[model samples]
Target: MTVYALETSGLTKQFAGFTAVSDVGLRVRRHTIHGLIGPNGAGKSTCFNLLTKFLAPTRGTILYEGADISRAGPAEVARMGLARSFQISAVFPHLTALENVRAALQRRRGESFDFWRSDRILKRYDADARALMAEVGLTGWEETLAGEMPYGRKRALELATTLALAPKMLLLDEPLAGLGQEDVGRIAALIKRAAEGRTVLMVEHNLNVVASLCDVITVLTRGKILAEGDYAAVSANPAVQQAYLGEMAEPAHV
Candidate 1:
């Protein structure tokens, strides 16, 4: 078995004549949380789209669990146990928290979304859906409409839905993007709990969370890797320092 759950090599993406991501290689170890961080316009989102197959790479390959998935479509890769969450919370606005998660469970079973199915049939997924909700700290909010829930809770619900897929690797885009300070710790904790027995690749701007949570951090700048290492090593790199010079002198632990 390979040590990496996800790997990419010589990955490049070009828009018209401009390069968005160039010669990037990323390897995410099995069962570890890897952080991807960089300045705005650093190609983090583009790289993520390539990995998830939302956009085909102009060059190079993507491997998931040692299988080449470079040419696979998003749904195909998703069925292969690779799932991703968007920066924006994606949940059925009218669906209750439990229902949203149940829907995902049904999808994972290769069943068409049968929201109108008889309760007797849909009830089978209820227990598992509630458990997943509880896993993300949404136990008491089961009956609330996803859109009515607080932003942080909605993010958690999105996570529960992603977990319903039972992915081997998870790609989280800015999981903490819109969260307030208080909610940051809560969501970050949920992410930590979710990482158990799974590999996570996250693109985030909050360096403190990355400092605490990531086993390895890959820094990108101007469409290429600027530095990569544990928080201490990557934060100390002169190149990384210069890259974030005006924005942040250095990433500080809080």
Candidate 2:
């Protein structure tokens, strides 16, 4: 049996009387890119929140590398090497790309905020931050404010900041949500490069990106698992096609 990097059994979440996620099981292999997809309101986001500990699970367990973390809070989970992106806007708009990554590194070290400090302490993070920025393909944009960057580059900056945390697994909620075709391709490549030697589980609506990039795809519908397989297998599933892809395939009337 292959040891999974992240696993969940009977994971569930309920808000008031409505169940957002119900009895879902997931097994994501180490160093692999996995895709979670569903129609709007399919509980994909809720599942992500639960995994990252943003929302406590009302029932079930979550295991990261075989350790149960069902009740762990967000900060606890993050300390355990699971990092989430795009949840709270990881990048600071006012800071330069390099500064944003430096800040994340500072936080990772549990460094206290010292408003009186000069660049001396901040300079120590510069080397590491610059390396991270280069890794995310933002080498020359170091001086540019994150907010001033192009839309796609800003997303890349956000990714660099997340990497400063040195996570074992990355939970990306819609990494490819907003972008033109060119940016889509660039970000896709960047994601593939970033997934090297780490586990990546993303919730994306772009089936093409998921189909092309993910090794395993899990389909969710109405708060339950509809299917789990490779892109080919899931795409060929008639039930999946009917429930999801069929809607995409329907032609607009002339």
Candidate 3:
């Protein structure tokens, strides 16, 4: 059996009196894709926020590589090799695709990105960035302005930037949100290629993507774990049917 690369036990988040997340226990195995699925307001994003250290958990613990990491800050957690991709794609619009990736590389390598350096000295960085861009299938678009690129290419660049951070476990938040079918497939392939040797946990609403890519599924409802297992097993659970599947099921199935 696969051991977990990341696990959260009894994770909780509260906003004033309302509990936004309630004891979300998660286990993401090493080198596997794990999916979190729930309706809007079901606390999927809050769980990601807690894991990414954007929100302080009101209760419980998070363990990474067998040590505690729940209270760590965002940058601290990132340094520990866990990074998040937002629901919305984020890139430097004014920069070329290559420049955007190089910036991320510079940040990761602790290099100053100031103009004090000669243009010739930046080639090493460019080489590194270009390799990552090509890995993400952005080879020829290196010189294109990020804002000028098509939407999917921009997102592919977004993943390349994240990949440049050298994360060990990636927390992807709604990576396919707002994308059409073709774009989704393209990005999905990028994500699959990205997960080759690391852990990936994502909050996803697309049942097809989750069913196709994830090795395990964690279903959330009302801020708690409703079900978890392989896709078929979780989808067959009665509580999931009541809380989530009713709305998510096809009309004929409903």
Candidate 4:
């Protein structure tokens, strides 16, 4: 197997002659949490879209497990063991947490939505979804309406839903955007725990969160990578400091 979970070379994207992401490159090693941090409009989301097959790259190649997945459609990419979370919450608001997760498990199992399936057959899915709910700290909330959950827990539910897909790689976009401190802590821990032997790539505005969770950090600006290294080195880069307006721990290079 390829040592890196994801590798991109000379990746670029353009919109009507405007370069949105240019000559970006990255290498995310297998079984580690990798952070992609940048300011708003820095092409963080755009890069993610290209990775997940939501957008086509204007140039370059994307290799996942040594296979080119850049041109693959979203479903095809997902079936290759890649799953993603949107910057906005994606969930079933009306269903109970259990039902929501069951839906995802059902989709992954390739079973018809036979609402008439004997309760016995459905129980098998329920059993699977419950385990995911428990893993995400929704063990007690399994029966709660997903719409009734708080913002953070709802995000957890979203994670659980994706977990139903049994992904080997995860792409999380702004996972902490609207979370409270407590909820952020919970979800961060969950992500870290679930990361065992799986590749996690995240785009975060909060450098603190990224610094703590990421084994490697890639700094992006104006659609290209400015620097990439461990926290200490990347944080010390003058270019990254300049891009984040010196809000980060290290000073920018002059």
Per-model CA lDDT versus the true structure: 0.93, 0.87, 0.86, 0.87
TM-score quality measure for candidate 2: 0.94
Top candidate, metric lDDT: 1
Residue lDDT tens for model 4, 33-72: 9999887788898899998889999999999999998788
- Which candidate, 1 or 4, would have the higher TM-score against the true structure? 1
Top-scoring candidate (TM-score): 1
Model 2: per-residue Cα lDDT at residue 196:
93
lDDT: worst 10-residue window of model 2: 245-254
lDDT of 1 by residue, 1-254 (tens): 99999999999999999999999999999999999999988999999999989999999999999999999999999999999999999999998999999999999999999999899999999999989988999899999999999999999999999999999889999999999898999999999999999999999999899999999999999899999999989888888888988444666766
Q: Flag regions of model 3 displaced more than 4 Å.
A: 245-254
Q: Which runs in model 1 stand beyond 4 Å of their true positions?
A: 246-248
Candidate 3: tens digits of C-alpha lDDT, residues 13-69: 999999989977788889999999887788888888888889999999999888799
TM-score of model 4 vs. true structure: 0.95
Pairs in clash, predicted candidate 1: none
TM-score of each: 0.98, 0.94, 0.94, 0.95
Cα lDDT, model 3, residue 167: 96
Off by over 4 Å in 4: 112-118, 250-254
Residue 2 of model 4, lDDT score = 78
| lDDT for predicted candidate 2 compared with the true structure | 0.87
Candidate closer to the true structure by lDDT (higher is better), 2 or 4: 4
